[model samples]
Target: MRSADRVDLVLRDVALPHLEDGHGGAGAGYRVDVAVHDGRVVAVEASLSLRGVCEYDGHGAALLPGLHDHHLHLLATAAVAGSVDCSDATTLDELGARLRAGTPRAGWVRAVGHHEARVGRLTRDLLDALMGPERATTPVRVRDHSGALWVLNSAALAALGPLPDTPDVERDGSGRVSGRLWRLDHELGARVGRTAPDLAALGAELARLGITGVTDATPDLPRATVDLLDGARRTGALPQRVHLLGAATAAVPETLTVGPAKIHLRDHDLPTVDELAARVTAHHRTGRPVAVHCLGVEALVLTLAALEDAGHVPGDRIEHASVVPPALLPRLRATRVQVVTQPGFLSARGDDLVRDVGAAEQAWLWPWAGLRAAGIPVCGASDAPHGPLSPWQVIAAAADRRTPSGRVVGAGERVPASLALGGYLTHPEAPAGSVRRIVPGAPADLVLLHGPLEAALAGVPANPVRLTVVAGRVVHDAG
Candidate 1:
């Protein structure tokens, strides 16, 4: 082949996404060869008569557009690598042993994934006893599994110095600080001192999982955090393209694209409907859409009301529409707002929901098929650190809706495997819209799985990826 016909890379004998049947079966279509050059697909044919600087035999495996995690906390996901995970602890002793064994970071022991169901309600006194006398001087902060609350030891409270005068800071009957803070991530971080975790490892993990892009949905991100993410992307510490949803005033660097303005609503401390509507309008006036965090029915109702009052924008989204009662479905559909949900929550917290939530409410928890059938656009996300990070695990959860205990939470909510996979194939800006396909002139970000689409979807392998390419550059190869 002439130099004009040469390309940067070519993937031979791979099945494309369009060839997959609606039910996850491999439809009748001959495997095709794809040519990539200058970060975009240049040619695709039954047999590409072209030369490539590098070539790989796909062995009739499925080649798909790289996955995009629609909503997750990038910094928290990276930071979780160093924190003790209390997710699997079933008793107070197990939780205490985990926290005690964890090494301290700057004399602070940070733990995450704590559940009141498993270890009971945590307080400063309980944490003090859990840490024991030897480590009494060390401060500790344990985050609830919901990521909405934080229980801190007395040492942790004292280490932070003066507390902010906010109702979020809980107090006991004696008017003493109870060490349980609700929806105070920013306040706590400011007092604790912010530290950006290295993104190199996180980047590699994402590549291994075939993720080519992500949306950092951390609300009201500080300027420092924005700069950190931009710098990481530029330095290739984080190679995946980023869409950052942060403070309205955040001056986004060119390295990162600005996403929808994030509006976080807590049931315990919700803004009035009018106030929330004003906030939405303010962001919309500046030509930016708003992505509201609504984990409870109350918050969801408030958010829907606010959206109706403020009117909707093209990219406006409802993040984690975690509890969508059937009554609210019509209202939600009327708003025409897209929902970016985390199916991983079912696998991660479904059992807890079964035990704690009322049976009537449990049926509507993270409704996937219900939302889709209602004509409401929907997308899947990991919501990492609070939920599982792997998109495969998330996809499986969407198809099965099975909890850790092997019980199906919402059988009616389960969607086909192809539909679950389609969630990750969507463009970040147009999530809940059409899925991106491996066509000529599209970005060369792609994943080659170990087997065909049918086999991979059926087995849900832990590491199904055979190779991952980002912008015509090989980022990961299983070999």
Candidate 2:
């Protein structure tokens, strides 16, 4: 072979997904050599006679497109690394012990993944007692697992001086601040003055999980956050390509792709149908689709009605669609609104949901197969910091629908492992659309599993990836 034909990299004897049979089944895939050059796949055949600048013996491992997390909060995920994780704390004492053990950062103690069901409701008095007198004056804030509320201690609340006269700031029976703040992220962040976490560690972790791309679903991103993300990408601190769902289209830098306009809605503060319709129309008029946050039935219904009034755009989506009753399946299908859901929620918070929403309503929570059967485009996401971050863990949850207690949350809603995996292989811009494949012209972003697809996905290994490549460069190599 001519020297010109030499490729940048080559993987010999790797199995590629075949159309003849379903993934992981007998005789489902065929083995061949894949060559990459200039950030794209250059050749695939029985044997590659040409030499490569770099080569690896796959030993018949399955090669697939790198995973993409359709929805997540990158900054929050990074920041949570430093916060006290209370997700595993079942009792108030356990939660308090964890919080007290965590060293304060800048004179503040930040905690995350707190569940009200496990520890009951939190208040300033309760936090003060939990922290003890030694740390009574230290500012403390704990984020609910739902990512909807912040439970601040009296010290933390006092640190802000005066509170805004808004319903979001809850008050106790005596008309004093209750220490519960709802949807006040901007206000809380401004007063707390916490700096952004480094993205390098988060990016490396993602590459290790074989995630080559991601869609940051943080709504209404400030310009500073956007600049931080762009700088991270440019400096290679963040190796994954990102799609921003909240950045203004015109203001977005060329390095990052703009996604749908994010509309955050709460059932308690829902807008009128006309008001939501107008907002959707405004976004559509600007040639931008909308991704609405709909975790409950009421919010989902409101979103569907707004879409109907404003006319659904091609890229319109419903984030979380967490609760979808049977009656709304037809309406959801008719709207052509894609759903980007988090199956990991089942594994992370299934028991709490079972207790809160009841066993009868379990079928309606994160209905993956049901939505797909109804002809509604559906995809899986992690919703990290709120849910589990590993895509493999998410895929396992999707396939088994099992909670931490080993109980299946939605038995009928379980999907095939291949289908669950396919959700992450889709284009970020069209998450519920076609799955990207490994072809000669495709980008060289790929993952090489440690074994055959069947074995790798059998129980969803903790880390099945042996190698990860992005833009023709090896980002991760287990060897």
Give the alpha-carbon lDDT of every model. Answer: 0.87, 0.88
Query: Model 1: residues >4 Å from true position, as ranges?
Result: 1-4, 19-29, 247-250
200-316: candidate 1 lDDT, tens digit per residue: 999999999999999999988888788888889888889999988875444887888888999988778889999999999999999999999998899999999999999989999
Q: Which 10 successive residues of model 2 have the least lDDT summed?
A: 19-28
Q: Which candidate is the best by lDDT?
A: 2
Model 1 whole-model lDDT (C-alpha atoms): 0.87
- Runs with alpha carbons beyond 4 Å of true place in candidate 2: 1-4, 19-27, 173-175
1-479 per-residue lDDT for model 2 (tens digits): 35457889999999987522212223357899999999999888878886899999999989988999999999999999889999888899999999889888877899999999888899888998999998888999999999998999989988988898777888877889989889888677778888778799999999999999999988888888889899998888998989999888877887788899999997668899999999999999999999999998999999899998999889999999998998999999999888999989999889888888966778888889899889898989999978888998898899999988998888999987777788888889888777777889999999999988777667646779999998898989997
* Model 2: colliding residue pairs: none
Candidate 1 backbone collisions, by pair: none
TM match of model 2 to true structure: 0.96
